[model samples]
Target: MPGISARGLSHEGRRQLAVNLTRVLALHRSILDAYIIEFFTDNLWDTLPCSWQEALDGLNPPQLATMLLGMPGEGEVVRYRSVWPLTLLALKSTACALAFTRTPGFQTASEFLENPSQSSRLTAPFRKHVRPKKQHEIRRLGELVKKLSDFTGCTQVVDVGSGQGHLSRFMALGLGLMVKSIEGDQRLVERAQRLDQELLQALEKEEKRNPQVVQTSPRHSPHHVVRWVDPTALCEELLLPLENPCQGRARLLLTGLHACGDLSVALLRHFSCCPEVVALASVGCCYMKLSDPGGYPLSQWVAGLPGYELPYRLREGACHALEEYAERLQKAGPGLRTHCYRAALETVIRRARPELRRPGVQGIPRVHELKIEEYVQRGLQRVGLDPQLPLNLAALRAHQAQENRVVAFFSLALLLAPLVETLILLDRLLYLQEQGFHAELLPIFSPELSPRNLVLVATKMPLGQALSILETEDS
Candidate 1:
């Protein structure tokens, strides 16, 4: 929850960060490239230098959590008995420095309330049909879009990948922004429309009951549109929906809340190519799903740099919630063994059919309850292998005993996760800057609540004080 305050990155700052990422990523490519599922099959432990293995081999889950992951328990001091390699220590410090700060610079709706006690009910109406995590996301993002639209003098707000319209409704009805919600799924669009009506009715009743208590901000429901936005080409359907009353001269602010894969790319493209779009705020996820030909290396600098390529596995790893996993390690719960259990299953799978490499196994319920041998049998059956295959009890026990080592390695990989996410976001910011637009990346949400917390904000004009204002909670 703690991080450095947000600062806008200069052109030179971004370039240096990119160069630093390229160097660090290459130096630690072995750790990043090694998938946890291939731990036994690939002899992943041996892959680490003997010095690293010695230091990390005996670490308990809680020890790994505090020492390597920087999540110290209350009043717990971490003192190492065995001297760690200087290179390893440096890698930890370097990774932390290169990653973008993910703590929110902005204030939450709860904190912005005049009475601190009323924080719980500030967003009460908007909380219907929404989980706590999503409730937090929509309120923060909607407030941001409202500020951007007001600053840019945008007449409309376009919410791309507007799932179930939680964000669109909040922006339109709660913040009084003219919003257009677009989603690729027809069913989800219909569901959003239903929720919109339900919310409108609820607000009307609340207003009638307590007319003096409720502020009368002119509220409107967001118009829902069903369309798949393609990153390669601009869709007329996307642009034609805006019925701007401002003399057909519609200045727009585009926003996407957790737009997945190339869909986020589409938002960036539309913002760049369309003159109507005056500003953009995008939060992207599912990096593994991004297309190679068009999705990554958005700026020319990264494309030209050697060893800048991020394979699908590495990209997938970037999407993990580092903070959440660190908490799990601190707890040292049963779930920590899942990774080791799955890895052991992989070995059994390979022996059954040497060609079957890392095949997907369906989730086994209450897997931690099952013994290693039982879990392996169930996994084999799930992967269409014979469950009756000869058992290797000794090998399975050996793998189980080394569970701590497996967890330590996984934690190390997670330590580098933020750097990968940082590089991807930096590339987007650089891309916008390369095209002569001003862009800044800020961690707008709590990383624990949302792993993909960094939001890339861009405006055609220079954002001077607005950059800092975006971080400020309204008083």
Candidate 2:
């Protein structure tokens, strides 16, 4: 339960965790570095120590879920049936200790209501056009940004990467914050502007319907700006939008919900370098898109550390939902066979055309219903290969029999994924600390609903009491 908070880990603690992560990730680089499509051809199973293979081999999907992923049956305490090597066991324990906790410190809207039977009131008007997942995200993130605004005494909020302005609209209309939404795409910005008018009309109609209810409403819609954020430099377009009528340079809070790759980095850089931009609350996704030297390892400490390099494969794997996969494994669903089928198809591709290695296979629907031969045929056709190519039935059947092994190996990679994510986020936090700013990585969203749940919060000043109150329901 002891993890990073608003009052963050000490300098030494951050370094130590970084060191532990680098060492562990380096040790298991083979597992994390591998492509699952090469699971068969590259002899990935043999790469694991014989002891690990022995302990893991032949385990059913449900057993692997409970044992490796720590998803135990209700009231069932998980214990190892086979003897695992001490080194392997240590890896699991170390990984669990080093990864940032996905368990949120804050209570969700559904959890906060006095009447547990009632639906969430937090997302009322904001939930209209949004999906359930996006609805949950906008509500939680919007509330936090609102709290951050109050804590920082910032009236102006600039939402970068504000796609269709879901978060921006909620903050402006729902929370009454003076907001400006900046997005790269012109079309999305236009749509957000349209949605803003629609929501305003909806709220006005509600007021008309209920004459007795005196509700405080938003003063205006969020100003929409269409511009790409350059991580390397500050854009006047982003800065010019905030206008403070009262005093000095406009006090601003920069925010992004699931800002992709370098866009999140741009927010951090702006928060650090721009005097007006005093705060940041960013939840970043698509680690694979992060650029080397610029997007990752922003802190000198991590950059200098040996073996801290995270390749694209590892970063992509970090985005997967471990909890969701574990539930699928529990069901022992036939869909789990997809990985094995793809890997088998890879071997076939290589045999047919040696140069074509792991080509993208457009998804074949109803995968669970198809035989390995049928799956491979459809896969070859999708990849522009000969679907009529002769196949060895014996080899195909052999690969199909080892579906559990493929899933188990992929699970092992999934196990170390959080550590990769932790290193990346910690690098951001550490970068902020190096610049003498206060920052914390908070699991602000439900991991099940949104796997990339941790939001990196940084401010020019320490939050103090405001930190504790941010996670609690607003009274």
Please, what is the whole-model Cα lDDT of each candidate in the order they appear? Answer: 0.85, 0.85
**Candidate 2 wrong stretches, greater than 4 Å:** 1-8, 106-119
Q: For candidate 1, what is the TM-score? A: 0.95
Per-residue lDDT for 398 in model 2? 96
Model 2 Cα lDDT, one tens digit per residue, 1-475: 2233424578778988888889899989999999998999998989988999998999998888888877776777777887889987887777677788887865564643564433264534566777767777887888899999988888699999999998899888888899999999999999998898888888778778887754665367899988988888988878764665486778889999999989999999998988888889999999999998689889999998999999999999999899899889888889999999999999999999999877888989999999899999999999998899999989999999989899989999999999999999989988999999988887878786788999888899987777777666555
Cα lDDT, model 1, residue 281: 94
Task: Give the clash count for model 1.
Answer: 0
Candidate 1 lDDT over 1-475, as tens digits, reads 2332225457887787888898899889889989898999999999989999988988999899888988888899988878999988988888777888887754454543564333353456788888767776787788788888888888989999998999999999988888898899999999999999999888888888888857556677999999988888997766654574657678888899999999989989999999988899999999999999789989998877778899898899999998899889889999899999999999888888999998989999998789999999999899998898998999999999989989999999999888888888888988999999989987878677778978889999999899877765555
* Clash counts for the predictions, in order: 0, 0
Summing lDDT over every window of 10 consecutive residues in candidate 1, give the lowest-scoring window.
1-10
Clashes in predicted model 2: 0
